[model samples]
Target: MGTWGTSIKDNDAFADVYSEFFDFYNKGGQPEIISKKIIEDNWEILEIEEEKNSLWFALALAQWETKSLDPKIISKVEEIILSGVDLKIWLSLGASEQDIKKRKIALDKFLEKIKSDRPKAKPRKRKKLKTPIFATGDCLVFKLSNGNYGGAVVLATDNNPETAYNLVVTTRLNQSNKPTIKDFQNTEVLICNFGQWQDKADVTWYMPDLFYKDYADIYEKIGKISVDLEYDNKNHDGKGYLFKPSWTACWGMNNAADKQFESELTKPKPKKTLTIKQLTKKEKWWKVF
Candidate 1:
């Protein structure tokens, strides 16, 4: 309720949402329940039209101020982040998914930017986007520690009590150094926020050429590599924005249209047609078709 206090002036709807948020913040609101209410019930009443996900940021800031960065709150905030780009300015200023203290500092800068850059009237265009969070089934463009870029697909996610969430990913290990769209197979990886087992994960791989022959050897050489990557604007260039190694990067959920393309990419490609020589090798080749 710091800067939000100023904006609530003459806006009863904003005040109502603010009031309800603090009530839940202090009285222990069910994260999932309250989140559903915000999306379904209070969406219009919140009076945050220009920035759709601003209320989540408001609540996130409130939680930060109140020293309540629990998994419940974090998970709910993450849902809002996945839905849209309302928090672009904040994330672009380096607001992170790690420590509350660091995020508080980043949020301070974000609020200041909002105050200073508050337009007297609405602008024609929206702000530019920052790095996006990769959701399940979405294609990933990753830059390795060796300065090489690789393509991957987020297979699925699971809730782990120890780690915030686990990501099962299919990767093209030993693929081209340059980033390109290719069928990923032969390797699977799991990503998590943090834990004893998860913390030891070496995201970077030992090239499976000469040095590494088996999974054990590759696992042995697993170095602590940064997982947060910038949104690859469909460019496949190796350029990507970097985040603090400690902060868990946020991701944007793919919309239906985006999901369609991803599904196509994940589907098995048709096999090549048999050559004339191979066809002639079999006496009953014509029946094979």
Candidate 2:
């Protein structure tokens, strides 16, 4: 005799419910009806033999009852699994014993493949900063030797610092007509005019009447001008203020000048006003009290 025959067991309501559910499903009845019947009968048998196949049947029934029920079940199952549980225990409660075994095997294979095929994430590379371009002959107004604002004229071409320095030296000698470099150094002439090198010449230079217009035109032909200030402060010990000519400032000044000039050109005239009077007739009646 088998052990099953020797042992005594109580047949519960779940047995009847399961049979009814299976019968309804086999008969192609609505799954929702079957699920409700099973729930009403209090069938708690989540794990049984052939659980996976049984679950498929149950889920199919659930869908027949309500299309979204099966998907809801799947979501719940995933959430429960991710929440943490012993794999063995989780498997035990599945539709059946065989399903539990198969799922465990599949899970192990998936984990092993993930471990073998995964690539290590590499660190991201930092981007390099771009050097800015500056133009030549830009006038830079700065404090000079005698507490007076002096403009440094840019004389170098657009090139590296060393090349610009050489150009400045050559241009200075040519301008002074001095053959000796020492004679050129004694004059308050600054080399490369670093202070003014980056500053852009005011657009007023293009206008007809500016005093420096001719000099500005000559400077433009020389090279790209820029202020000599350190462009990139990455190596600087601390932050420092740098002066640069702003187009906004220049535009504002130009607007102000334009307004002043317009005011002088056209004075405000007094507004003339005219007045007129009209007469109308009316009748009044008095009542005696």
Deviation from native of the Cα of residue 32 in model 2, angstroms = 1.4
lDDT tens string, model 2, 186-272? Answer: 323321211112222211111111113212222222222333432222222223421221111011112122222223235432122
- Each prediction's Cα lDDT score? 0.33, 0.28
The C-alpha stretches of model 2 lying farther than 4 A from their native spots are 1-20, 46-69, 84-102, 106-289
User: CA lDDT of 223 in candidate 1?
Assistant: 20
lDDT of 2: 0.28
Q: Which stretches of candidate 1 lie over 4 Å from their true place?
A: 1-105, 120-140, 144-146, 154-176, 179-183, 193-289
